[model samples]
Target: MFELKIERVIDAPVAIVWQAWTLHYAEWFVPRPWTLEVIENDLRTGGRSALMMRGPDGEENSSEGVYLEVVPQQRIVSTDALKAGWVPAEPFLVRIDEFAEHAGQTRYTARARHWSAEARDQHAAMGFEPGWNAATDQLEEVVARLKRG
Candidate 1:
């Protein structure tokens, strides 16, 4: 079981940060210039989420997953990316989002668990740092925009 976790202290309230994550921000939550469209986001426990992300190379990646747990503006645990309507994919991926408030700011942590050690190593070597960090940077921007509005 390999674990990859990244956390950032976002300069915003927890609620605003949580909204940016749960809402349809995948349309812009990537390192490259791409778009993410959340086909369906049922935010309740055992609900479903389906997203289609378009890459700069004009590639489209569609993922369908299930919400395993949700604690308001605090935490979200979901299954790995699957086919539409919660169908499991080969070499599945599970995602967890842990949110909290610290010193009046929000702490956003995203963790991913892969099915194999080789997959984990591959993701790490393939630049999960740059990819996720860049995405988080965009996340901060989204939160800032919400605060300004």
Candidate 2:
């Protein structure tokens, strides 16, 4: 599998970071100039997280996927965001989020793995890194602000 990974140390606890992934906070971490509309989310293994978000161009993008793995405050794994909950969408992508304590600070990493090199290249060509990193940065900022209060 081909993968893309981004890691950063956020000034927040594990639990605080965990909340950022939930439906409540997800609404904010969505990339700007676009909006997220969550259709359903159970957030557990075998559960679904479906949404139809509109992009800046007024196009609606549908993402329906399931939670493949969930380890509270430690790790999360899920299938391609654009795939149906039951099937492996070709060029399938799996997202994994891992968190650990580093000198009392939370070290978090978000990794995205795709099925093939071409698929990985396509995602990169689509500006995956910049878009996702921006969203993650936004998530970090929100978590920090929430933790401050």
Candidate 3:
């Protein structure tokens, strides 16, 4: 398995952290000033996962995929390997997100598993670490806001 991973302990309860992921993902999924537009959030197994990312330069990129697995707040596994209704497409990577109760906070882990080492390296070269880390930081802020209200 060629994988790239990021782990962080968010200073919020698992429930809030999970809510940030499930409900407020659009607020933190991409690093700003890149914006995300959620086309559909059918957060269930085999459901659609689609979003468009808009850059500050007016550049736009769309991602359309399907959820491979969903386990409530515990885990979310999605891939662009297949689209809705099992339509095959050009493979990129499978994303795995795991959330756990860590003492009084949330232990969050996100992994991108690619089809090959070359693919993994390509993803890393695409700024996986910094971008994901910034997104994770945004996630913490979202979680905090969710916790406050």
**lDDT of all the models against the reference?**
0.81, 0.78, 0.94
Which whole-number lDDT from 0 to 100 does residue 59 have in model 1?
A: 92
Candidate number with greatest TM-score: 3
Q: Write the per-residue lDDT of candidate 3 for residues 1-149, one digit (tens) a residue.
A: 99999998999888889888999989999999999999997999999999999999999999999999999879999999999999998989999999999999889999999999999999999999999999999999898888889
Cα TM-score of candidate 3: 0.98
Ranking by TM-score: 3, 2, 1
Give per-residue CA lDDT, model 2, range 31-63, as digits (tens): 888788888776778778777878889989877
Model 3 sits at a Cα RMSD from the real structure of: 0.7
Q: List the residue pairs that clash in candidate 2.
A: none
Task: Give the 10-residue window scoring lowest on summed lDDT in candidate 2.
Answer: 82-91
Q: How well is each residue in 28-95 modelled by candidate 1, as lDDT tens digits?
A: 46666867787878887778877788888889987777887899999998875554465666745688
Number of clashes found in candidate 1: 2
